[model samples]
Target: MAEHNLGDSHQVFDGEGKTFTINDKHVAIFNINGDLFAFEDACKHMGGSLGKGKLEGNLVACPNHGWQYDVTNGKCVTENECESGCRVDTFPVKTENNEIILSLPE
Candidate 1:
């Protein structure tokens, strides 16, 4: 695992998501009530960009198909009944010196 600095935490406003690339991997970082969460940028349903989605509390609605996912855990909330094993990849996030840091798998 490697930590990548994602700029200042304030760059991502509350209830918003931002996209970043670390080690050639695209990641979506979300800010919820001053907390940071990281996940894959692409939606599992149709390859939609989750970073461009709308954030509602801890859930982010996919822009392409309206699929909602929990930003904190990357759980597919829109298709919980389908049990399709469709889930976005989640990564660890932290803040140091007001900078958002994301852990990416090496």
Candidate 2:
């Protein structure tokens, strides 16, 4: 696994999300309450940018197709069988010295 220092925690406000490209990998980072969650930026159904999606509690709905995913675990919660098996990759995230840290698979 590899770790990256994304940036200041303030970059993501409570109940908001942001996108960061590291090593040519697009990552979506969300801040819910005071905790951080990271996942692949692209949605599985149509490659919509999850980073720019709408956040409702811990779920983010893709703006393109309305596919929602649980930000806490990357599970598809779109309420349909067509997307029952769809899921995005999630990464470990934390904060240190006020900087957001993210871990990706090596």
Candidate 3:
């Protein structure tokens, strides 16, 4: 596993659920209220980048097809729309003294 310091917690507070690239992978780092979230940048439906999607609390809509996902549990919330059971890859995030960091899996 590897660890990388992203930046200050405040830097991402206004840009939560926005997509960005990290370690050759697209990552969307966000802060909900005071909690931190990290997920794969792409949407399961059409490879749309989640950064361009709209945020609805902990859920975000895919820019390509309007698919929704809850970042905390990586689950789909669209009604009666049997999905492929895809989920955004999530990473553990932490804030220490306002410094943000990602705990990447090995």
User: What lDDT score belongs to each candidate, Candidate 1 first?
Assistant: 0.87, 0.92, 0.77
Cα lDDT tens digits, model 2, 1-106, are 8989987999999999999999999999999999999999998888999999999999999989898999999988877634556789999999999999899888
Taking every candidate in turn, the Cα RMSD to the unseen true structure, in Å, is: 1.6, 1.1, 1.9
What are the clash counts of all predictions, listed in order? 0, 0, 2
Regions of model 3 farther than 4 Å from truth: 80-84
Please name the candidate that would achieve the greatest lDDT relative to the true structure: 2
Tens digit of per-residue lDDT, candidate 3, span 2-106: 777877677776536555667687888776887888888877767888767788888888888898888786777876663667677888888888887787776
**Model 2 accuracy (lDDT, Cα):** 0.92
| Model 2: colliding residue pairs | none
Q: What's the CA error at residue 80 for candidate 2, in Å?
A: 1.9
Better of 2 and 3 by lDDT: 2
The better-scoring model by TM-score among 2 and 3 is 2
lDDT minimum window of 10 residues, candidate 2: 78-87
Ten-residue region with minimum lDDT total, candidate 1: 78-87
Residue 100 displacement (Å), model 3 = 1.1
Q: Candidates 1 and 3: which is better by lDDT?
A: 1
Q: Is candidate 1 or candidate 2 better by TM-score?
A: 2
Best by TM-score: 2
